[model samples]
Target chain A: MKLTRTGVFTIVVALAFLAVPYAATLLGSNYVITLATRVAIYAIVAVSLDMLVGRSNLVSFGHAAYFGLGGYAVAISAFHLANDVPIFGWAGTNEALIAWPLAMFVAGFGALIIGALSLRTAGVYFIMITLAFAQMLFFLFVALKYYGGDDGLSLSTRNLFAGNRITDARTFYWICLAALAICLLLSWRILNSRFGMVLRGAAASERRMAALGFPVYRYRLAAFVIAGMMAGLAGALWANQNRFVSPDMLSWVRSGEFLVMVIMGGLSSLVGPVVGAAAFLLIESYLSGWTEHWQMVFGPFVLLVAVFAPRGLWGALRGKGDV
Target chain B: MQLVLEQLLNGLQLSLTLFLLAAGLTLVFGIMGVINLAHGSLYMIGAYAGAWAAAKTGTFWLALPAGLAAAALVGAAMELLVVRRLYAREHLSQVLATFGLILFFNGFIAWSAGRSPLLMETPPQLSGFVEILPGLPYPAYRLAMMGVGVAVALGLWYMISRTRIGMLIRAGSDKREMVEALGVDIAKLFTLVFALGALLAGLAGVMVGPIRSVQVGMGEQVLITTFVVIVVGGIGSIRGAFAGALLIGMCDTLGRAFVPMLLKSWLSGPLADGLGGALSSVIIYLVMALVLIVRPRGLFPVSG
Candidate 1:
């Protein structure tokens, strides 16, 4: 209810992000709108990952597995529906209302299975197991020749958004922005609630939380599912944006990229991920424009940020105490 | 019968390669408490160096030392410049920093090497097949690799159990502060251990370069499997690494060769192939999961 400096800054930033499409239109550059949409989609994933990495003290190296699962869900369903074929005895539907929620549930279910097994261990084991599970899923998809396999599944058009034409870049961008804003708001509420406090307490000291009678595993599992579903939502949007889905979407490299965004944005803050995603995309665009080997420049830049700017761009901008 | 024997040999070769990489990884991780995602880059560097040297000199013998020296030098420089700062940091920071290093090395290698896999030729002296048993012949190069792996394993065991630096390394793993208090330059010791690990990884990369494509990202593929080895073997134990590598190598190689054939009786050819391929690829991960369920600390956890 009361406006703090952090709150005010967040609102201004959100407004500026919402205004990007209009500005891009005014400048007659639809490419900018599309790029901004990508940043927003990736921001959704980074924030979801932050719930695990930042708040829950669970550093998953396989978040991309869920994200990719979400994308595959949409692509597979759309493919089946287009061909009038039943997938595993069930008729596929292209309805966004049906497909998107199904995608979320599928990803959440995947998280449930993976988390149940991976959560049995802590520290480095958890990271490697998650990575291994994701790689398994990646290989599974790669071997599925029925789903286009390594070439990836392509959709003729974006999934219909309640009968609205999402083919328009501006319309799609607004949809992605809305999704990001809603996820951010939901995450903010979750982090402030009692459940979030328990999660944070567990992160700080798992043994202490357990001593205090908290079922740490269950809470952590809940957070993992929530984060996975949120990332899955982002994946659905990403699939729509690109009009394709591939094994690359679920690769360990993508998971690393998601982690990089969270770290580069400032791990402790809520809005840091969005800022990180934006900065990453913008820098990538500019660097790629300069040379074919942009990763040579981009990789070292990330290293510089990790080493020198431990506070990240947002933390530095907010100064010392704000985070 | 011959096919099974050949697959077993393949498994042995694969296991030895993994042992070389995992032994180094487990050592660095056990002693420094740093999870290095860029260790794979050291493997890639060794492969490139060896490939380049072998091509220039037209001799495999020169390439061996060239790869080891290159990897050791790079590993030492990396330790001094970047890794030393990460020793006191959290695992997340270490993961991120090392990940950045991976990207840098991969991109740098691609840029320098022109994005194509380089070719390495096995020396003629080690190219022919040799009889290992009655009616069973194996590639001499692969046999030589197994011999080297066994020799190195014995050498490592002796070094760790008998030498002064090995004593320091063992002590440091147990208690870093106490080792420093004993007036040992812990930093130099860490650098040396890290360089040694890198040297072993280089040895692996150069030896396997002729067998596999010497490409930019090859290190990453093997790196993940090496992690699986260390995890299943018990993190810091070299003996565990060796045992885990052999187990995984056998499981992977045998599964790939036999699973589809077994499935062929019940399923269509293409479907069985797909399922078998998928199952075989994930067999090690499944093994890792089961191991963690049974022994979360791994089979041979070294007490720290």
Candidate 2:
């Protein structure tokens, strides 16, 4: 594992992520730490999505359904826990550890239902259906008047851990860093496990894998659930960081932004999604400072890459070596 | 009942608008094999251009063709500049690239025209309603939309199904190699088809301007519905697109109008309203899901 390129790369990146926060404290680079924090969250989501998108070759347009649902779970949970409302009378925890896992469950469950129906579709139909499912979820959230609806929900405070002050910046950063590490490790293990091997073979050649006795559909659904859990993790962190959860988190546009991160960073490569998320956030932050309509400039530029450099950022950097 | 008749007319009007968008979208998918998520952006552009023109000249007639032309021209340029290069990429790349176009276009329009809906006045000739039944009447503009939509559909059918060029499109869908073997300029045919599709989308946008206010990001809401229609109708199938468009239009409108009323009759009013509103919005998607379950290739898949 240590010798493998992905493993080595992961270690180096993880070290940098750790070193950056400490360095931020030393050098007073809170901005950089904050930026890295966002990158870490987005990367978790992107890597999880790669499980389905890259490993299984299931292009989902509704991955945001989990993301938005995860945020809602945290928000709604906080609402109930703070008000001392029971889960139909059972006490709820206001802590993120419990809330985070619960959010993951809700997100994963939703993905399970959507993927079951959508995975049955392939090619163009598959794309549109997945997209439509995501949009449907988006609309549902938008239409709900109970929890901020279109306006969104804002938490009074970040979710607390059992004994730790999660409100502390450096502490929160380390906690996020640990979560990211666990997520990446889990993703890598899943891809290399026996299950992972079968999944990849199915992606490369679904028909051949089926003929060889693999239940391709189940693997794809499992991958989708895995991906949804990852996105839910991000959404949970995002809610804590921003203390807000809105339909915007689950929009098709936001989903598209994730796709951009995956592509610009390098699709099919584990490190690519992380790198892409970092670069995208950094660039967009800088560009938006210069002009309000930076998207007009940036949009075509990204399109140029998609059109001309289909290999994406990672692909362009490593060439055939990465693939 | 007059309510049913009126809803049918509204549905027909809506169907024509959808047909325009769907026809262009499905053709691009069928012939070029690229998912232009920004097809809606092109639709948006047409609306913007036409609205700008109508606002400037104070004449809806002149603005109509100007919008159509502007969209067609932009479509050609887009085909030449960006869309052409994306033909061989994976659908994800297409989705991303076009999505970028959406962001760009939305921002560009906002910067240039401000983020407000542009109001276009309807022409006097098309603004009146005529009595159809003893006590019921329909808006003339909606009737005109149905007429124009039917005419355009017929024109497209004739062009594709009855003309020499039509044979090329039929061949192009299934046997591009064969069409190229026949010494036809296949590249030109592609450009023509893309341009035609763009023109139709533009026509839809321009015609829709009179019905509602034109604004930024309007293309997005419509784009999804059009995609639904294409999926239900079967990509690359014109007749299927038409039928799917009408079915979707009717289901969407009637679902919105009557679902809550029906639900109220069965359940308590408040619960019915809450769930009904949500269910009404999902009616089209529900219809689509059922259709796909039965006919995965869509209701009227083009043989090609």
The most accurate candidate by TM-score is 1
CA displacement after TM-score superposition, residue A27 of candidate 2 (Å): 4.1
Please count the clashing residue pairs in each candidate, in the order shown: 0, 0
DockQ values, each candidate: 0.71, 0.68
Expressed as tens digits, the lDDT of each residue in A220-265 for candidate 1 is 9999999999999999989999999999999988999999899899
Question: What would the per-residue lDDT of candidate 1 be over residues B1-304, giving only the tens digit for each residue?
Answer: 9999999999988998899999899989988988888889999999999999999999999999999999999999999999999899888888888888888898899889878889999989999999988999999999999999888888888988899988988889999999999899999999999999999999999999888899988988888889889989988888899999998888888988888788887998688878877787788888988888898878898774
Q: lDDT of model 1 at residue A248?
A: 95
Clashing pairs in 2: none
Over 4 Å off, model 1: A1-3
Model 2: fnat (fraction of native contacts): 0.55
**For each candidate, what TM-score against the reference?**
0.98, 0.96
